[model samples]
Target: MSAGSRVELYAAIRRDARAGMSGRELQRRHGVGWRTVQAALASAWPAQRAPYPPRASKLDPFKPVIDQILVVDLDTPRKQRHTITRIFNRLCAEHGMTDVSYPVVRAYVAQRRPEIRTEHGRTESAAFVPQTHLPGREAEVDFGEISVRLRGELVTLHLFSLRMSYSGKAVHRVSATGGQEAFFEGHVHAFKVLGGVPAGRIRYDNLKAAVAQVIGFSRQRVETDRWVAFRSHFNVDAFYCQPGISGAHEKGGVEGDIGRFRRNHLVPVPEVDSLRELNEFIDDYDRADDDRRIGHRVHTVGEAFAAERQLLKPLPVEPFETGLWMTPRVDRFAQITVRSNRCSVPSRFIGRQVRVLLHASDLAVYDGRTPVASHERLLTKGACRLELDHYLEALIRKPGALPGATALEQARAAGAFTTVHDAWWAAACKAHGDADGTRALVEVLLLHRHTPHEHVIAGITAALRAGALTADAVALEARRAAEPIDSAVPEADGHTAILTPDAAVVASLTHRRLTHLPADTRPPPTVTAYDQLLRQTTS
Candidate 1:
């Protein structure tokens, strides 16, 4: 019987005995064993049942043998050490210990193996130096790679992580590359997301974007010129950790944060249409993370951040422009290739050098003081980013080129060339010949330089309904559609110029009167005409 049951029985038996009831009656009432009843009647404290009797283990005789094997393994290479299975096999074959189960031998080895290793002095453990972080004083930065499906294709995205040591708050963003521009852009984005920059210092690994050279065995670094400029621009200082493997421990917080966030939130590969969409998901995940507490800290991360934010350096008046500037010559195709991806420029810029500012997500091509073109940076290799407008003039000369041109294809994909455009082009081709029709379509596309897209579409629809297949007619209707609804007068320059009464009066009043006849003209011929006028007045 259990101790509680025995105790109950004992109390009951004592109570019944005090009442002059016999032990037999007590046993009959409690339905307990006879021995239990006797014990209960004899003693106040109930005795616990004895544990199961000890039996000789099958592994006992082989204990010394297993110990000897483990001792020998200590000297051997770790890879050749004796596993439990090996020990069990040796016990059966060498020791001739038949009928010994593997589990029996395994259990003995497991309990005794650690002791043997300790005797041999092979066990070791790692120790970490405790760290203290002041609020908004220190942060760590790192980049990790994640796979995301963008536009139905799996793409490798570089994730930049910045973690505040005090609050355990972090900011994460995905970039197309780990290039210097992206590195700088990531910092700008992280600072904005955190609402300010760390007041004291930020630590980093020896990323090539930041560190140009590592001097000797020390952590002294020669930072890249652009990186130094960026640091100066932000008015923040940087501390580089020991280079390579040894440095991983210095930024352990961010290292751990990257792994934890990746596992908790991004384990199932994210599906998104663009880097922008993927970052929105990351932003939401970061906001949700503020509710979490770091380890056993009483305050949540957001609460801790609320305190730390006050200690941080106030944000600068303007964000630093995060990009790399280069002068690249436009190729014969009017395209400048960046990182093996082609981006189009104006045809007039071909064979001439232009300024290219390559940002993390986009790039701008400039001619001296004028911006020639801008495009979203292509992440994939050998991909081309072309704007059809850049090639419209050239395509007008080679009308046949518009149908199969790469620029046209890009335009169609970007929705700049819509189904309405296609319908108008086909209608034009039927009304005119193939070459002339393509030229007309190109001219209509050129209207986008001045007309809004919705206005152009409306014009196309209106012209199609009115059976006006001419590009000029289409452009006129598009401009009319774009006119303001509340204006009292229509635009003058768009339609042909006409002499309104106000314009006629202003032109007539502004004409200059001749004071004398020019030497080159017949002099005094005006006097004869005046004499005739006077003669008519006298009559």
Candidate 2:
């Protein structure tokens, strides 16, 4: 209604009241409700009306069901949790609640979902008390998943970041896993990088690597035994935040560092040859980040860290072993199983137990205290990392297996079995039958144990060209390839180099011999041995 009309209505009612007209009579004459009559009698202008009481919604009966579903959804994966339509359908089917419309359900769910989340402690409320941090007293640690291309393969690595609560200085490393070993190793890396352990407690979430169980919504935790040992060894005082909020509010420094570092430094998805390379990249960024000023601070991160370093506790003289120690028996195939992944050892180690030092990224097999083999740790279950050199003895005995061996396949993939090796093997197989040729190739492969790999390859190429398909001939050629020209000496046996050296190639050595003897003595170097190829060809 227009204000002028409302004013005229109120004026007529008030003028009647001033002339002693009854309230009921004014209401009847004005054709208005008693509330309007009272309002007009009370004032010449309209006053704001009192709000009406809320009427119950059709969804009221099913709200408890909605709350129960949302409460259960807290334990479910986010994507698999309930939706409004799903809730509405459940209410219709299970509770026989068809009176509630879809719009009503959606509206109630929209209003109640977050409230339910907060009530159940699945979400933190927006308001948080601001905290004052003292230097060297506290730190925060967490792991975040980061994807990078390692040697042209896209691999997801867990990045461990530890940020000083006061200084904003942090250290970051990428590991193959976020398991306990990596967790412990990450702490060691941070402590070493920062030069000491925090004098006060380090804040952490309920990481499975540390906390085996959160004690029912409280700050208490049943920590893993290994984590307890690690903490004691490092002289670390560990403080776990309340389980419900996931410790993010208490440890925002490391939480923010993980995201901020990933955005500013790890963007474009770093491509590196190894985890070592990726970590070096992270280290460079961390050093550069030290100069950054955090949130109106007078001192830069590095400057603050420099002051904080003096307050840190000195590290222990003895270091803790971060790798897991195990003794896995080598199987018949000369392979040992470490956490469901297979790695090969030398054939001699078969049926024997070898000590394994398994780190996050790799595992090393030791015969007693002497390290025998080490392979990069395999992430996928049942995966194998076979080294061909470990199987050479077996391959020499059963040459048939050499062609189809998994070790050979891995060697080929690793470039240890090159095209040159394949070419030489093919040539040998052509000269002899497949079995004998492969046997001879195996013998040639055995030369790699004593001879340089490049020299062995050269020997194979030379023997293939000369049609000397025997392994002995390849060995002779390999020795000749390894010999220096001036120091070349002929073996006084049936075996000799197929090709003789030219005089000009060793003229200095020949001149020295002639000068020591009479002029006619010490005849010049000859290619007469080389001419045996022509004679045999003609015959």
**Best TM-score among the predictions, by candidate number:** 2
- Residue pair clashes in candidate 1: none
- C-alpha TM-scores of all predictions: 0.68, 0.70
Q: Residue 122 lDDT in model 2?
A: 75
- Model 1, residue 498: C-alpha shift (Å): 28
Full-model lDDT for every candidate: 0.85, 0.87
Score residue 273 of candidate 1 by CA lDDT: 78
Q: State residue 362's C-alpha deviation in candidate 2, in Å.
A: 0.6
**In terms of TM-score, how similar is model 2 to the real structure?**
0.70
Listed per candidate, the RMSD to the true structure in angstroms reads: 10.4, 12.8
Off by over 4 Å in 2: 1-126, 244-246, 450-455, 466-539
